[model samples]
Target: MTRIDLHAHAFSAHTAPKVIATLLTLAHRACPGFAPHGDGTLPDLLRAEAAAGFDRVAVCNIATRPEHHAYMARFLTALRSGAMGEEAARRVIPCVSLHPHDPDAAAHLKTLVALGARMVKLHPYSQNIPLDDPATIRLLALIRDAGLPVLCHTGHDVTAGEDDFAGPRRVVNVLDRVPGLRLICAHCAAWRHPETLDLLLGRPVGVDLAFQPATGVEPIIQRFALEHPLEHLYFGSDWPWASPAEHAARIASWGLPQDRQDALFGANAARLLALP
Candidate 1:
């Protein structure tokens, strides 16, 4: 069976060390006691994937601020065009991003598609835009028409502390507003609120099993796999912050049939992204 990790974040080695350090600082602040396992580089991430038995990963690229859009676009171009290197190009399915506040956000989405991005990544907390923001809705509609799914960071991001931007209600509300938007709620639908799973039933939205909190919500994960559309259930490890292997192991322990476990760990995401 194919294996693809639908969510992982790593920086190009060409990235400046200072930027990596600053991002790491904020990430560490999110969980002060837990130290990440890998250095914030593509090579480090690739090694981790190998150790975890994943075939490839959809590396989520982000532009945290409006001003960072152009810079991230360049990196996205590099990764997709194999400018990052043959290894990265072959192993990565680049999930592109744009800041909601950017004046050319629509055009940015076009460029990302033109650059061959397979999926999109959005963060309400990090990008400082609510899911219901007019600009965000507009962009999401465009993404839907483009036939691309977006991995939306839902609920809270401890690093940024904006709790209301992507709470479970807002995430569901955006679905009503956008109609058929393919929004994949990150952090296991909504962190610390596994009950939100009841709200998500029957919706076509996607959800990833990731982060440390995910392991604690064993009942939610098990029920989600058993009841929901398995194709929308992705295996995410939020790598560096947590181990991809740990997430995979948790899924393996669920006593699901081999094919079901295969879909949860990798095949479903492969179908969604159409990644090689």
Candidate 2:
């Protein structure tokens, strides 16, 4: 089976070591007993994915602040240019980040796309911006115009408490403003927000199974999979934060039909990403 992880994160060579360390520290502080499968470096992420049996992995980079935008563009450009070694580059898909506060956000996005970025990742909670804010709407429009899909960090973050920046209600509002947007709601349709599933049921949106546990959410996810169009679903590990093999195993345990499992594992992502 061609397993493609639609969501993951890794730091490029250009990323500051301090930034990587800070993120890792924050991750550990947020989730007690959290042990990252790999360090936040690109090479480590590639090896981790390979060890987890992933054929392809998409790295979703998030620029929490405006200053990180340029760095993100350069990093993705280098990755796409195969500057990070060919084998690892071939197995990785780069998703650039966009921040609403950046004055040149649209231009930066255009440059990143020209440099071979096929998708964008948004983290409203980390960016400290509301999804439906005016600037965010404009950014979403620009992303759609650039012909790229966006995988947004929806629902609550483990570290950030009670922030609904990318919650289901806000995402629904965003859809209302931007017609025909190709958005993927990360974290199994907004973790604790099952209502998001119904809200986005018939829309042109994709939901990734990232950071979702099988014990409590598997039954809900399975029910949604059966009730909704399966093509709208995609498999994601949220690597470093979760185990790809474990999540894959959870999906396998769902008892879905072979075709549906295949779709969830890769087909749906391939179609959405226009991957050959």
Model 2 weakest lDDT span, ten residues long: 212-221
Using all chains and alpha carbons, the TM-scores for the candidates as numbered come to 0.89, 0.89
Backbone clashes in model 1, listed as residue pairs: none
Candidate 2 wrongly placed segments (more than 4 Å): 12-33, 201-204, 212-216
Best by lDDT: 2
The sequence of per-residue lDDT tens digits that candidate 2 reaches over residues 78-126 is 7777787897678887778888888998788878888788789998888
Candidate 1 ranges beyond 4 A from true positions: 13-30, 214-218
195-270: candidate 1 lDDT, tens digit per residue: 5677885567788877565235567656766666767788887777678887788777877777677887888888
Colliding residue pairs in candidate 2: none
Superposition error at 77 for model 1 (Å) = 2.8
